[model samples]
Target chain A: MKRLVILAVLIVFCSSMAYGDAYRVSMRWSAKPGYLRLVLESGEEIIKTARVYHSYSLVKVEFQSEFSFDYENTPDAVDISHKGSSLFININGLKDVKVFRLADPSRLVIDAEIEKTANAKTVPEEPVKPYGLSDVVMVIDPGHGGYSMGLVGSDYKEKDIVLSIARSLRYTAGQAGAKVFLTRSTDKYVSIDERINSTYKKKPDVFISLHMSSSPDFVVYYAKMDTSIRSKDRYMLKYSQLGHLGDSVKLSRVMAEVLREKFKRKVRIISMPLPLLSSIGSAAITIELPDGKYFDYNASNRYALVNTILKGIGKYER
Target chain B: MKDNRYLTALISILFILVLAGGYIYLIRMHPPEIAMENKTEPSSQPVTKPGSEEHISIKLFFPEGHKLVMEEREIPRVFSQKKILREVIREFLKGPAGTGPFIMPEGVILLSVYIGSDGVAYIDLSEDLRRNFHGDAIDEYLLLKGIYESTISNIKINDVKILIDDKEVDTIGGHFYANRPLKQLVTQEIKFD
Candidate 1:
């Protein structure tokens, strides 16, 4: 009897060791325009089985296993459940709970907002305002710098070529009445995280990443949609992170078409999951210039490229 | 004395016959086993020269704008899959005779090709590919698409895993995600109205 009990205990221990440990969840909060964004960080992947819902003015995000919260009590997160494997946070005034995931140290983020029509007894009046390009903001980024010289061609370097173009673009875009911001003004090393953070700070209407290719041809690309996600999850993620994927695709298409029509250059538009463009909170695209040898740094050429992009953005208004 | 000499010669003949019989018995016993062992060893197929009458033609792909254009070339007909792949890549990297963009970087060299049972082709390229690439989205896309199209056209490959200097890179040109096995890009061709 004693031997059998010991064998059973050993089998249990081995099986548990083989499966490894479950995921632990940590939480943080940030302020958005009209709501609070609760971010949950997990060391392991947040699987498809994780559940999140709202009930009785409280947002409950439940996982299969228990976790610990290492965050201070914020004003947005009114209360939190400490029992069991569930997180019941009191979002009393907030409505419409949304959840999604981010890569590179996986995080399951949740966003909730206070609906404007929640307590309204009658239809609200719509306000119409004057429209101009003043509100439109464009953020341009030149790829690679510092130790990373990018691709060095026979005569010109990629970093120099792109920076010159981006500088030209900023000046030209100003003529079109759009506020322009460059991620790096000089030949400095800027990490992707810093670029993203800076772009987010500006809350720009569009983000364009400028780069040069080895081939003497131009190509445009939009952020590719992740097909692995379920339709529902994709919708939430697209809305939360990108805001409008349709706008991004349209922007890239228009930019490509405009470039092809004006410059007589062979241009192709593709969808790829480029981090700089994909993770930003605006319609974004990356424009790859022709090979270094073919790069034209003349004022007229840069002006033309900038004009083409501005024209493309004009179509977005219509 | 003559009978004694004849008896000695008979004994010598008997001794030689016994040795020969023993050798034959051992060979007969081990023949099947030795043959089976040789059969179980990996197969080595000889490469057929292009000049040979039985040589076959294989198509190689190159970048034409955004599309991959096919150009056929005759190579030594090698029966080994790995050998066939190596020859195909060697010819493909030599650039196509067609008047279009050069498919790869100027000094890029192919290190090796690994084909797995899961139909994934892992291509090892020299560091020149990553180092000399014109850090642009279109340039990287064209290079990768051309190589992928050429490889898939020449061989049966479901996915392509690209490795530069024996290490996987997050992005080839700081744009396209390349950490995972790349599938065929749909927008590789320009459609005319």
Candidate 2:
């Protein structure tokens, strides 16, 4: 009888704890007169007809609506307040939330504890100067798009993998306060000439080309010859790193080091003659992520690689 | 008493098997084995056989119908006359014939060369060589480095210096710092678009 009673109490406690877990809320506000749009992660739509206000040097809108509760929280659920453009929110028991504002298709982001629910009253003030490293623009080039399949891995395509990683780097770098540009957002063929020309036009502080490796049939055969023999495919593909922009060895070295550290992968900085590297006076580094038969495209590995790149960009931020 | 002994013997066998399995598992999981398998391979092939066919003389050949006349000059041997540098250069230019699609560049015209006693070979280029070559700064640097380093390495020259019309230039086209001569290492191949 005593054990049965204790078991019932334990089950009730576990159920309540699970019910109290927080959930994400996102909303998009668009097509307003002055205010364009507001999007949240929760997928909730909040349309406001309030007048725009400028306080603390930020643009904000005020609206009166009943806040819908999506997740359970403690009695002192942290209240997020926004008066102008700036937003202020505190997690109940968490710190170090990453925030970002993407500009191309403007979106404000806030990552916090999801369980807490509170009404925000004041948006924080935008900083007088941007709070990131200034005068640094990173041009991320995802190698091989469209017709170019660029190193096919068993689990994923190299082009797709590189683009995803590049996009993540761009986001993290932007958060770190660096202007970032992608050579091509979608799958499209960018010629060697165009790739170099694009860098010249952007005049980016640094140019990073992301790529992956493929196991050629020769490599598979060679492996049979000596299981210990390293694949020559890596060396054969390394010829692609050569660019025709005027020589900037220092830039190449720095970029190589940063990429190697971030990806925790083996990289060869080939000093080869190519038109793209020659024409672009900017420091350019080509990053080749491990591909087919080399590395698995798992989420944890991807996260670690992305985080390493973010850390590398952070070093150059200031 | 017989049942007790049988049970004890069975237990002893099971204990030994478990101990052996754990030992093998620990050995497999050791960190050194992981690193030994994951080491990166060396980038460039190591140079061997100083004067072997592996170190072939690269010649620059003109198109079949082109009207550029050639004059034969005595081959200079910085170290020994037996290893003729001029004969190698002349043979390289006259041997291969192809324009695009992986052949050497047309504008890479080698003029006069001065071999130093210190195994440093100084090759002079025509004034039209720089104008004829079309590539970005890094590409040009790499191309020039490749041409110079490959020639020097095959010829057993230690260092290479580039000069245009017998005058020292800061850079080939104001891109690479060619003010000082470069030492020969691995020759980087240029991929032309």
Candidate 3:
């Protein structure tokens, strides 16, 4: 019986020797403006090198040194597991994942761009946003009018196409519970000054301008400072869009994502000094649709376009 | 005695060759001053014109289909950078003599050109410059690009800050940001063989 006990103790010692004491790592999480940040930290060893592999919803990190981490505080939308020598982080819903290493103390940072709607879904009955339609106001501008005939397409003029889209956005957005206004609802020339006046008076939460162009399928733009202005006028002009630049950038991202999905095309966002948008004191973006003559302007396409804009606004609000 | 004579002949021949080589090298390096003074090439599309100490080359750009085509011209060196700038604008305002639309509107006039100590050229234009403007984004971009490209083509000037009727407006048109100078535009495109 003594020999039997000795043999069991020897087996236990051999197994413990085979697997060295595991490194204790800590995992932390926080929600940023547009993404959820996950941080894994190891104090004793610097993670000098790591292989990161990500697909649709999973981010896997294989470390040079195997470590065990407590995933107690993992968000409802995410699952964390450690197996073998790899750490697997499963993000529930997202547009993208970025994994990078930070030093000073060893750490791996994971940023998952979660869809706003998906975020709300994860938290049941917890109202995450005060962004109902009635709380949010929007202004839509249709480029050109009457004497100023926008570029002509196969069956429609640019002015005509923009007016139709602007009108559709107003109705669709209104039905969605947002107070929406249009710079010009009819086929009339609304001067840039007039549009600026409309934005100034409306003081909306978001302002969207619609147009069409060739070559590029679709483009979204927010305000960029025009460094050309000088003196007292410079102060006023610079400040006009300064306060809303961040809002515009965030809004543009949501808009671009939704528009990209709807059109199944690359949606580019740029920051340029657009006189019309720059001079207006509002969070604004201009979306230029495809102006190709062969492009279809059917009713279903229009419906999708309107829904796309509304979806973008809804996501941004959330 | 024969060896001495052979050495002298070889030395004389070597000296003459060295003199001839130096003469040819100098002739290539410095053309006759008269010829250098007289040499001037009319700038055309895609061709850059070079100038000497006595003159400055004006490189102008004009809108074609989508992009601006560059044209270089030479003018006698002036006393002030502002004067040289005016000449450049004047050449641009004259329009492309060949074909296509004028990059600048017909009635638009340059009210003044002011060069700041920091090397930014503040170009003031008449209200007609803004009032007479009509086109889309491409037209607006090309118009500003031409003016900015031509002004910076001259040396000593760094950037271009555009003004309307002596005051800074948001932009010439509602498309691009104007109140700032076109400092970011390329001054030269160095092509290698």
Candidate 4:
């Protein structure tokens, strides 16, 4: 009778172990506000949460088994596909993936892996409701334009590079089904105050300022500036959703990690007080892409950057 | 047994009283009245004769380095100001060579400067300025050199030590370092940007 009972217990334990083969994904925490990131064992399929500022808004979801999938953000849903053993994602119609590695508050890395016998089609696309009590809206600010070329490199101008990246971001964001607005689409000058005022009118869920570095060196740089303009009224309106201005630090880290992996370049993220990065009422981050001066901004680099960013948006889409 | 307990209690009380008496005696012997009075009073003024100590003012210049330091001294300022210090810094943003429209980008740079007691000037920023600055090395060199050079020249000091911000920086976006300090070449050459 004792032997039979032991055998029965062993069989139950074995079956439970066999049934539960899920990979554990872990994330490092920082004081900044943004989506929580989790890295899978495969280093290819990263899971991200919707935009969140308050700690109470964080949510964790576990998968039964690991699978390979590349994601692109669209208005209705995220387009996800798997490339055999690897994950290759396409955004809107753009191809290629770029990853950015950033370190400031801390390093947050997103990696994915493929599960055997699981096809890309098996993974379902789920719709996300807007963040907060109201609808989700995002403001995209392109850095430098018109007469202000910002940083001038030998081959490209900072204004042009940021504008292109911003346009791509806007397209992907719109496809993700969020209301997106751009401070300027053409090569025209918009005063710093005007940009701030426009963002205030929309009362966005997040603000992303796009810029490029002018360092003759090919290093990835990230900056967040502290602004003196303390709008008590604005703070009261968005404080619960946006947390504080310091959330930019978290947003920069997440975006930098994605950008670095996509471009395969030495990425460095910095924190500073600047008008554009500091003016947003919600979570804001400024991304400065390599200006192809010290480094070659070849086709691979562009595709990698675009694909990675789109995937990140899809993962973080609300 | 009751008689023994009473005797023990009496002895303990006597010991306590003796200790208290000793403590009070020590306290009375070292009273702080005199010391406290002295501390509360102020001292009288000092009288000095004319020409007992000589005061001198000196200026140091770095025309190319674009920095200046002014020192005023009684007699003992010589040894404190004459030590050798090394610094690695990027070139300033504006200078004679950088007067044109272009800019340079490159690596870490070294600069060594010296200071003297009398503050006379002799400075050197030549090829060393361009040594580590890349691409537009000339432009970077000119900017750094112009700032330091102009500052030293305007000051009347004969000797100066020009060190960049304490330690070595990788590359301020792609400039270079010379790694050595030069003597003051001229005083009038320093120009302010």
Output the number of the lDDT-best candidate.
3
TM-score of chain A, every prediction, order shown: 0.54, 0.46, 0.56, 0.49
lDDT tens digits by residue: candidate 2, B51-142: 66334323232222212222222233323221334444545434334343312235555687666655566777676554443222333444
Question: What ranking of all candidate models by lDDT puts the best one first?
Answer: 3, 1, 2, 4
lDDT of each: 0.65, 0.46, 0.68, 0.41
Q: Report the C-alpha lDDT of model 1 over A1-318, residue by residue, as the tens digit.
A: 999999999999987764444455667787643467778777554544567887534677777766555677554224466567777775423547778877666677877774321111111122211223555798999887543456665445666556666765676566557788999765556776678778888888888888875566787877765555555765452323455668878888888888889889888777765667766778887787777577654445655665666667767655
Candidate 4 lDDT, A196-307, residue by residue in tens: 7788898886677765554432222222322332666445432322354455555555666666666566566654333344456666655556554765544344444545
B1-193: candidate 3 lDDT, tens digit per residue: 9999999999999999999999999888865432422331223212233546666667788878656888767767664556767888888888876877674658888888877756677888898776556455545667787788777666355678889899987555445556667654222221111
For TM-score, the strongest prediction is 1
Q: Best DockQ goes to which candidate?
A: 1
- Tell me which of candidates 2 and 3 scores higher on DockQ: 3
lDDT of 3 by residue, A14-70 (tens): 877654443656788987434799887765343556677887556888877766666
Better of 3 and 4 by lDDT: 3
Q: Give the C-alpha miss distance for residue B192 in model 1, angstroms.
A: 8.0
Question: Among all windows of ten consecutive residues in candidate 3 chain B, which has the lowest summed lDDT?
Answer: B184-193
- Write the candidate numbers in order of decreasing TM-score: 1, 3, 4, 2
For all the predictions, what are the DockQ values? 0.16, 0.04, 0.05, 0.01
Off by over 4 Å in 3: A1-134, A153-155, A226-238, B1-56, B61-139, B155-173, B176-193
What is the lDDT for A155 in model 2?
40
Can you tell me which runs of candidate 4 are displaced by over 4 Å?
A: A1-136, A216-243, A295-300, A313-318, B1-93, B96-193
Over 4 Å off, model 2: A1-135, A214-248, A255-265, A316-318, B1-193
Q: Global lDDT for candidate 1?
A: 0.65
